[model samples]
Target: MSNDLAAQHRPALFHRAWTVAVIACLTIVAAAAFAAMPGVLVDPLHTEYGWSRASIGAAASVNMTVYGLIAPFAAALMDRFGLRRIAMTALVTIVVGAGLTTVMTDVWQLTLYWGLLIGAGTGSLSMTFAATVANRWFVRRRGLVIGALTGSSAFGQLVFLPALAWIVDHQGWRPALVTLALTAGTMIVLIALLLRDHPADLGQRPYGATAFVERPKADQGAARRTLRVLYGSVRDRRFWLLAGTFAVCGATTNGIMWTHFVPAAQDAGMAMTAAASLVSMIGVFALVGTVLSGWLTDRFDPRPLLVGYYAGRALLLAALPALLGPDSGAVIVSWVVLFGLLDVATVPPTILLCRRVFGADGAIVFGWVNAVHQVGAGAMAVFGGFTRDMTGGYGPVWLLAAALCAVAAVAVYGLTPTAARTGDPAKA
Candidate 1:
C-alpha cells in the first residue's frame, strides 16, 4: 500500500478504479432496491394474502439470513471465479427472484423467492463485495472505497425507495415488483460491461501499489474455504465481540429501520410516501456518515469509533417511539439526519478490525461476520413483526434494540485485536 512508481503513473484526472467503484455502487443500489422492497410490500402482502405480520416477517427474516449467510461464500466464489461473473449471476438471480414475486400466492412462495433468491443475490454483494473490490483495486484510499460502498446502501434507498413507494401507491405491489426486476436487469448489463475481477486484468497495478500484487490463486471449493476461516476465527474473542456488536448494528439498522420503519410510520398515521421519503433521507445522510467513518477509520482506532457509533445508536433507538408518533416534525427530521449518519457507519470500522485481527483471511472473515449481521437483522425482523402483531405497536421493538445496542457499546468498549497481540490469528 506504500507509494510506488505505479501510483505515480496513474491517470491524472480519471482512474479505472473510480469506474469500478461507480459500477460497484450501481450494483449495490440495484440489490438494495430489492432489499428495501420488503418494507413496502409487507402490509400489502398481509392484506391481500391474509398472512399475519409474523409470517410475512418470517419471510423477511429468511431473506436477511440468506443475504448475510451467503456473503462469505460469495466472497470465496468471487475469488474462485471472478467479480464480473459472480456479479452478473447475482443480478440475474435478483431479476428472476423479483419477477417470481409477482405471481406468488402462498407465503412459502414469498419465502422461496424473496427470502432465498433475492436475499442470496443481494447478500452476495454488500460488505463482502465492497471488501473484495477495495482490497483488489486500490491501496491508497482503500477505507474510503469501503466507506463509499457501505454508504451506497443508503444511496440505494435514496435512489429507489421513494419511486418504488410511489409505484406501489399508484399501481400495485406486483407492478412495483416488475419495476424492481427490470431495474436489476439493467444492472446486469452494466456489470457485464464494466466489472473486472482484478486490476491485473486491465494491465494496471492496484492504485498506490509500488509493486504488482500477485492475485492469489484461490483453493478449490469456496464453501470449504469460507467455513475453514470461520472455524478458525470463531474461537477468538475479538471475533465474537466484533460479531456481537455488529449483530446489534444489524438489528438496529436493517432489521428495525429498513424492514419495519415504513410500516411503523404508516401505523402511526403517516403517509406511506412520506415515510418512505424519510427513509430515503436517512440513506442520503448515511452516505455522509459512512464515508466520514471510512476516513476516520483510516486515521484512528476503530474500536473507540465503534463504541461511540453504537452508543449514539442506542440513544437514538431509545427515542424512536416518540419521534414516530402523531405530530412528529422537526424532531423526526433531525432524527433522520442523525440516524442516516449512523446507519452503516459501523461497517468500515468492523472491516478494519477484521483486517487487523484476521490478516490474510480478513475478507472472508468479514463475510462470516456479516452473516451474523444479517442473522441479527433477520431475528429482529421477525421479532419486530411479532411485537407489532401482539402489542399493536413497534415501541417494544425499538426499546429492545436500544437496550441491545447499549449492551453492544459496552461489550466492544475496550476490545482489541488479541490475535494481533499473539501474532497468531487462530489463537483465541
Candidate 2:
C-alpha cells in the first residue's frame, strides 16, 4: 500500500490491537534484560574490581537519575515523533550499551556503559510507554492492557534473572552482557517487524474510541488551550500526591529491591544462586500482581488499591529483617512472592490516574511524575548501599523503606478524583 493511501484508509479491526500487544512485549523484554543485568552483575563486579558496595550503588544511582531525567523528554519525544520510532531508537541504544559492557575494564567504564547509556535506553523504554499505549488504545480494557504491559517487565526479570545469574557465575559478567545484548537485539527485530506508532497509523480507530474523527485544526489559540491542560496538571495537588506516592514506589522497588536485594541476601549468608532464585520468584508474582492491578484499575478507585499495595508492602518490609535467614527457603520464597506482586503493580493505576487528571497530555505529565519516581529510586539505591557499608547490615534500610511506604499510602489516599477541580479529565 502507498504510504499516503495507508494513512487515509481504515485500519483492519483487531490488527493494531495485536500489534500493540507484540510491541509491549518486545519493549518490556528489552527493558527487563537491562534491569535483570544489574542484580546479576553486582556481586561479580564487586569481586572482580574490588569495588565498594557504596560505589557500585552510586553507579546505579546515576543510572536511575538518568533514567528519571529521560522520562519527561521521552514523553515529549514520543508526543512529537511517535512511539515506534522512539522505542526502536531506545532498543538500539540498549543493545549498544549491553554489547560494550562486555569489554569494560574500570569502574568508570561500568558507570559509562551501564550507568549512562543503559540507563538512558531503559528510561526511554519505561512506564511512559505503558501510559502512551493505554491512553491511545482501548477505552474499555485500558487498565487491563496497561497491567499486562507493566507485568511484562516483571515477567522479563523473572525469566531472565536466574539465567543471567548462572551465566555470570559460570562465565563471568561479560558473557552475561553478551547474552542480554543478543536478547535485546532479537527484540528490536521483532519490534521493527510488528510495531506501529498508533492505531490510526495502521488505519484503524483506537480499540474503544467511538468515532474516529479528524482532530480540529489547531490555530495558535487552540494550541494554547491544549498546552494549558498539560500545564494545569502540574499545578494540581492530586498530581503531586500521586507523584509523591510513586516516588516511594520507586524507592521501594527499584532502589532497595532491584539494586540491593541480591547483595542483602548474600549478607544474610544466602548463596548467590539462592538469592537470584528468590529474586526470580519475586518476578513471577510481580507479573501476576501487575496484571491484576490493571484489571482492578478498570473497576475501582485506584486510591484504595494504592493504599492496599503500599500498606501491605510496608508490613512486609518491616517483617523482612526478622524473617530473613540463610536456610529459610520457605520464608524467603514467601517474601519474594508477596513483595514481587506489589512491586510494579502501582504503575498501571498511576498511569490511569494521570490520564484521568491530564487528558491528551497524560504522557508528558506522567513523564514528570515518573521522574519523581526515578529520583526516589536513585536516592534509595545510593543510600541503601551507603547504609549497608556503614552499618554492615540491611535492617535499617528496610525499616526506612517501610516508613516510606506508609507515608506513600497516606499520600495516595489523599488523591481524590475531584481533587483537580476540572472534574473527570477523561472528558477533556
Candidate 3:
C-alpha cells in the first residue's frame, strides 16, 4: 500500500484534491459503523450477559470522554506525524479494538477495547480531520468539501445500521462487532493506498491556489500546543459561551440520544430492528440538516442560528418521552425526523463562530471546546444509565436534557451576533 500521490502539474478536468476528499468521506462513513454500534449494543449486551445498562453505559462514557479528550491532541499528532500516518494508525487501532470485542468475557474488556481503544481511534478522526482535509486540499469550495465530509457519517449510518440491526437481532451481538471491525479494516486499505499527508507531498498546491506554497512545518510538541491553546482560550467570555453551549449539545445528542434512544424505544416494547431503523432516519435527515445549516451559516449571524437550533432541540427533547412505542407511529416518525434535523446542524454555525472568534487558532480552540462537549456527553451517558437503573425509566433524563438545551439556547442568545462575523478576531 503506497501513500504516494504522484507529482502532477495542472489537473486536466478534475483535481486530485477531490480524490482525497472522497477518501476522507469513505473513512468517516466507515467510522460511523462503529459509532452506530454503542447504542445498538446496550440492550443486546444486557440480554446476553445480564450486564446492567449502567455498567455498559459506564464503558460508553469512557469511550466518549476519551474520544473527545483525544481530539485536539490527535490534530496536533496529525501535524507532527502527517495526516496519512495518523489516519492509518487510527484505522488500525479501530480495527483491533472493534475486532477484539468479540472475545471479551467481562466488562473491563469492553472498557479497554470498545471504550478506550475505539474512542481513541475514532477521536483522532473527528470533524477536525474533515476540516484539515478540506483546508489543506482545496482553497476553493472548502466549506462544500467539509460539509460533504461531515454528511458522510449520515450516509454511513443509513447504509450500515439496517444491516447491523438485522445482524444483532438475528445473528447475535458478536457478529455485529465483527462487522464494524471489517468496515474499518476496509478503510485501512483505502487510506494506506491513496491518502497523502498534504498537497505538497505530491508536489502540488491546494486546489485553486495560484501559486505553489511549501508544506508547513510539523508541530513538535502536540500536547503542549493543545494545552497552551486551551489556557489562552479560557479567558475569553465568548469561548466559555461556545464551550458551554457545545457541551450541552453533546449531552443532549450523543450522550443520551445516541447512547440510549434505541434501548429506550426497545424498553417501550418497540422491536430492536424498528428502533434502529428509526435512528438511521436520523442520519438521513441529519445529512439534509447539516448541509442546509452550512449554507445558512454563510449568510446568517451564527448566534441566531445557534439559538434556533438549541431551542428546537430543547422542545423536541421535552416531548421525547411520550413519543416512543411498539408501533412506528406517525408521532414517533415526526419526532425522529425533526430531532434528526437538529442533530448535527449545530456544527456548521458553531464552527463558523469558532473560526470567526478565534482566528488562526480557531480549529485548535474548537478542538478544546469539542473536548468539553465530549465530557458533557460522557457524563450524560453514564447519568442516563444510572437514571434508568434507579428509576426504571429514562423519562427524567429527557426532561433534564431538555432543560440543558434551553440553557444552551439562552447562553447562545447572549453572544454578540455581528461581532464574531465582522470584527477583528481576538488574538486567542
Give the per-residue lDDT of model 3 (tens digit) for 256-359. 98889888997899987888888889888887788788777666677888899999999999988887788659999999889888888888777667777766
Residue pairs whose backbone atoms clash in candidate 3: none
TM-score of each: 0.95, 0.91, 0.92
Which lDDT values do the candidates have, in the order given? 0.87, 0.79, 0.82
Best by lDDT: 1
In model 1, residue pairs whose N, Cα or C atoms come closer than 3 Å (at least 3 residues apart or on different chains), thus clashing, are none
Per-candidate RMSD vs. true structure? 2.9, 5.2, 5.2
TM-score preference between candidates 1 and 2, better one: 1
User: After superposing candidate 3, which stretches have Cα over 4 Å from the reference?
Assistant: 1-13, 154-159, 417-428
Q: TM-score winner between 2 and 3, please give it.
A: 3
lDDT of each residue in 273-382, candidate 2, tens digit only: 78888888887888899999999988888878999999999999999988777988677788888898898889888887887776666767787788889899889988
User: Which segments of candidate 1 are over 4 A away from where they belong?
Assistant: 1-13, 417-428
Order the numbered candidates by lDDT, best leading.
1, 3, 2
TM-score-sorted candidate list, best first: 1, 3, 2
